[model samples]
Target: MENSIILNPEKITADLYPKKFGKAGKIWTVILIAVCAIGLFAYIRQLNKGLVVTNMRDYVSWGIYISNFVFFVAISLVGSLITAIFRLANVEWSTPLTRIAEIIAVSAIVFASIIIIVDMGRPERFMNLFIYGRLQSPIIWDVVVISTYFFISLLLLYLPLMPDLKILNQDPSKNSRFLNHLYRIGGSFWKGTKEQLKINNKAVTTLCIIIIPVAFCIHTVTSWLFATTYRPGWDSTNFGAYFVSGAFLVGAGGVITAMYVFRKAYHLDKYITDLHFEKMGRIVVMLALLYLYFNVNEYLVPAFKMKKPEEEHLKELFTGSFAPMFWFAILVGMIIPIFILIFKRGRRPLPMFIAGVMIMVGAWFKRYLIVTPTLLHPFLPMHDVPESYKHYFPSWEEWAIAAGSLAGALLIMTFFVRIYPIIPIHETINEKNEMAEKK
Candidate 1:
């Protein structure tokens, strides 16, 4: 007779429970808070001085803030990709990564909203959009879809989190009294009965179904914000799919980066094994290739035509002022990552982490290229505008605020990990039990 081994539920709980942050975590948190503080200070200055403090001008109306907003929107797609899409597809290897992706999605979307407000000269007028907005506008579409996506993403995050909350509440000894109290408040009604699990599973499945289109809509509408415009580079039918593919790529890179960080920080080697990174590396390669194809479609076809309106803009990106950053984004974001992740040995944790960072950094520059260069090369051409209007560089204040927004997003994820099990404990136990029985 063969002996079957079963994972100890208590041991699993002990290994997976959220633990107090050590010295390094405390230092990291403090640094993020400090960056957020600096960003807030910069925002206040911008508020007091108005748009004059920044380098945005008539020709280059949109700047790094818009780029950051696009980046946030792009990265937020990961929640839908990892959590909802993976769940619906029944991909078991992704189980440990769902919450990490969810928190990143939630945090990214929250900052996306914030950074857009930071872009507006009159932040107070944001409510007027709701009071006096028109449905025909792509802006209105973006606002509606983003708000809808946020809520659905939140529910997807919370619904799956309840079971873990119940486990945390039941095991008060592992948590601080305050954390235990918060857990009970959140999960007190969750008795883990069959009916409750059934309803929860159903709700999660329903959200998975709903979030897919909503996720596509959110980024698609955002791409429309540019595509609907008559600007040189903005006029393209390909923007929707272009933006969506890039979003998935960046979002996946973000998840890969976080997977490595959390696995190291929390000593989750057993849970977040190299196999997960290997699988994600494959996904990233595919996404990067898809995005690269879109990049070709976006630029190559236009460059081939050299449309008078688009010629200067394309030149600026290809062999002109923006050439360095443009090539950096392409090579680092797509080509190099493709090469690195294409090989099996490169799928290991450290190499994958390096590739993930490359993808993210390159993606940010790619967004910048998408926004700024075209604005500088509008259809009307520069005439009688200030030399300052001919050029655009983010002011110190803009850089500070952008850095702060990124830091703030990181802070949200950091705090979430501190309070909740970054990996779902109850789900892991159930998976282990099933695996044991199968074995």
Candidate 2:
């Protein structure tokens, strides 16, 4: 008899199907929901009392909220990095992680939009962007590109889930009636016929191509929001590339972090193996190195000149009030992770998870460093403003709102896992078939 295949459809289905959340999962979901509730409450308070509730003043008008927005936009780049870029490159090993990246992208972008509105203070004025917005504004560009990227990321996510949805719909007995209904609604027309698969594949390929440029545009436009200004720190020709590189680095870190968590929580070791972590480890190291190179260019050239305006901004980050955070974000975000992931043993799942967490935390503070310090050190000296306006710190409401937005994103990923196969079931089966045939 011919040698048996490594992965049969039945086993794949059973292993990869979405399962009901157990006690720990339930507790986690509840916590995320609670955090979201707190954030919503904070937002309500901000609306009622106005922007004065936050620490934002004339000197530091852009506070942690903008930092959070930048962080979300950075993290959202992972979808294009893993899903579109990897798919177009024919990177087969990445199949298991694509959905994870896409969902992260979708959720991060969703919150990016929400947080920008939060930053606007007067939420009702948002509609003015559509009605009276000028094309000359970088803010308008950001609005356009981010919205476009969200839909493309959503489609990329939903299209791949169609085949898996059809599989779930076939056996309603295994899942709740509500879930069964959702599966049916999502995949009712997906007959999996040859023509349908061909069209689906083509459409996906087209989207994969389209999303790359749009993803770049989204973050590039965002960098322009700062760089276009003649402010000491923001005025740099390198800002666009600097922002894009950091975005990719954080995005990869996020996917790696998610990969480890899902593999452990869902018992997906068969699909998300050690090899996947190893490959992702390599990607993260390269990204970290690339980001470090840009970091050097971003600061070194400015430091060499040390213009009067930039002198204060750079000093504050180098050895002043922001020094600790500045170094922390640099070391933890890029340097230490590079050290950890450079060695072969460090690339293991547990170590990779540690490094991923470090990257994420470091990246968040890095954004804080990027936005807050520069605003405080504008070209013009602070006039006779209140002494409190010279320094900045987030208020309770700002913290709650920021934390809640993060929890909301996590809750989205959590609920998505509960409803759909976190790993692509049908795709994994197809890949296994191809491997077995080659043997």
Per-candidate TM-score against the hidden true structure: 0.98, 0.98
Q: Rate the local accuracy (lDDT) of all candidates.
A: 0.93, 0.93
Worst 10 residues of 1 by lDDT: 1-10
Write candidate 1's Cα lDDT for 1-439 as tens digits.
1113345888778888887889999999999999999999999999999988899989878899999999999999999999989999999989999999999999999999999999999999999889999999999998898899889989988998998888888868778888878988889788899999999999999999999999999999999999999998889999999999999999999999999999999998888888899999999999999999999999999999999889999999999999999999999999999999999999999999999999999999999999999899889886787787899999999999999999999999999999988999999899988888787
- Residue-level lDDT of model 2, residues 18-110, one tens digit each, is 999989999999999999999999999999999999999999999999999999999999999999999999999999999999999999999
Question: Model 2 off-target regions past 4 Å?
Answer: 1-5
| Residue runs of model 1 more than 4 Å from their true location after superposition | 1-6
TM-score of model 1 relative to the true fold?
0.98
Give model 2's clash tally: 0
